[model samples]
Target: MSGQRKNPQARDRTIGAQLKALRQEQTTLNLEAAARAIGWSTATLSRIENGKRHITSEDVAMVLTTYGVPMAQREELIESARTGVQAGWWSRPLPGVLPDVGTLASYEASARAITDWSFSFIPGLLQTERYAAGLMSEDGAEPLEVTMRWRARLQRQRVLPTIDYTAFLHESALQQPFGGVDALREQLSHLVQASTRGLGVRIVRGRVPHRLLLHPWLLLDFPDAPPVLNVELNGSSVFLHDDEVRSYDNMRSMLDGMALSSAESRSMIGQLRERL
Candidate 1:
């Protein structure tokens, strides 16, 4: 399973909405005429206007210019496009991990609300520094590189204290020994501490078998946009939007229902720490 979601459709729709509004300003410029003037396929223009596909910077510029937008107005649209295409901080390449980690990290940083569900391990944002180092070490990360990744992970966790976060972990994730007994113990303790500090931490008991087990996913909801479902993978991440968000949202609700309450979850983490 993966943990990153980039909803292309949401981005596309935003651009499309702008295009449609601009086109409506002039009655003479119909869809076909606008498409022709921009030297783009009518179908492609239709999809863009319908919010089905992403509109590139060039496409935005061409359409705005074709619509006879004043120089001042054109500058504003171009500026918007530039912001839209600008690479996020997470898009920077990590030494060993995929380069796209930066892109996902950027999304996480800007997101208003984050809901994550994990089955095998603690989500990166919740990982303790020691646990993060151990996990990266096991993945064969270089010693120095492991430290860098751990720092990155810790930075990601800072968001929890500053933003709204809800995390659901399977019982197996809590019980599993990520690095060693000491590491797992510390990790559990960290979770308990985080819970007390306002992060929502819930654990789904192994005994509660449910359909949500079919796909463990993370759903990220932004302040001014639709939610995104991140399909985690070992090597690459896939982002799902629109219809996929609905499915993940349903599963998230079911999983949340089966998971322990916040207070109980804190107690459970404490109990696990004692055993460790």
Candidate 2:
């Protein structure tokens, strides 16, 4: 643990999941019962299980001892909890930017794959600087905050090459010139070039039934932990985990069946750029 580095947030997530599994499988106690046995409040235990609270090696030992887990398994989990924490840029968030942006970046940093389903705008990872600034301006962001947010966005986009990235975008999003016609054309051109790289640029054609689509959401899958679904709202966001992520998985499957292939999407984008 001395020489190795780890993201504390991701470490907590994997540790928490493993502990939750241990509790359910090795013991008959429910969450409430387990908390009582460990002399911890239910809320604290629940937060630990959900990876919303910081946990220490001692905390892992206490829970495992209370559950009568075998010493070998207990040692393994405690060792994992002992890993050193490394702070990321998200630790000190950019002033005036939405706080949830940091949390989203943290998750993105640890994701093995990411799927973005958007209906009204280009996904942030796929947006150009001008296009992103235009969006911030339209939403009434102050000029300074807009600059800070896009700088943060540029940092987040660095993970695109490291993970399996895909964006399922509706045709209408391409038609809206948020940053004016020239910027829009440049954005479309960027998308075309991105498809030539490894990015998955699947286009969801317009006029599809409304029931088949939903508001924008990002699903991030981890190598060891459960998948997380991030649904953005006005000035805030919600992260869904475990069973709650199933619906989004189904939605992704549907989109996969309907979206145009990368080649087709590239051609469509080129055609749209020409029409512009």
Candidate 3:
């Protein structure tokens, strides 16, 4: 039980177990029968019950309604699903890291495509090792911990070659040196190299008039799943779903249209490197 408590996936599975129990108490329906009644696949139902997938409100409603749950019981199950979706191991704290780091890591690992807009700093996936280390060090992290964090960050970059990564970076982020001239140079060079390797890189020139019209945000898209939007503040992160993603999608397109083309972006970055 203790071991299960320590694993987020296991904890989610337990919620699925509860949902399964509710269904069982309501009827003698077998998995196939119940799944067919709800218009879902047996495999999907099985995955939900096994805690392999997150149960949404729609899923809860379908299952409870299919089992002929009473209004009162139905409301209870709906609320349970709401609470269950929010429960995850990343909500806990780890020494020298933000509470939301685990959750962020999990989402990134599962994401099929990532689109982000940055104004102040370079996106983590695009940061070079030295640039990442220098930025982490400036945050007051100890050397050893910064090294570990950099390693973890670098590992996350492995997803780039295999996944679709579209980054819309504000021109100011390119102009402002994060870790000194040399570090920024390497970072820009790295960005150009990555673009050559097939990553979608767009630069939103700061000189563009009316550029401050929209707020900075990050948008993530998953395969066969709903998109998620994220905004990071000084010490915390906020995750948004569904309608919010739709809004960001519009904003992302606007930014993309305003950005320099891939070739032009590389040339701009190269010019910046020359200035250094």
RMSD of each: 5.2, 4.1, 9.4
Q: Tell me the lDDT of candidate 3.
A: 0.71
For each candidate in the order shown, give its overall lDDT on alpha carbons.
0.74, 0.85, 0.71
Ranking by TM-score: 2, 1, 3
TM-score of each: 0.79, 0.86, 0.67
Q: Count clashing pairs, candidate 3.
A: 0
Q: In candidate 2, which residue ranges exceed 4 Å CA deviation?
A: 1-8, 24-29, 54-58, 61-84, 211-213
Put down candidate 1 lDDT per residue, 159-261, tens digits, no spaces.
6766789999988888777678899999998899889988989988866455555555667787655666777776567777667689778777787788889
Candidate 3 C-alpha lDDT tens digits along 1-276? 111232233234445676688778879998898888888789978877865555666667778877888899789868765665444434453456653566565566657888878886788888987787777778777987777667666656766876788888887888767677889999999989988988988888756435433445667776645566777666567777556568678777787789889889888988988888
Model 3 TM-score relative to the real fold: 0.67
lDDT accuracy of residue 210 in candidate 1: 57
Total clashes for model 2: 0
lDDT top scorer: 2
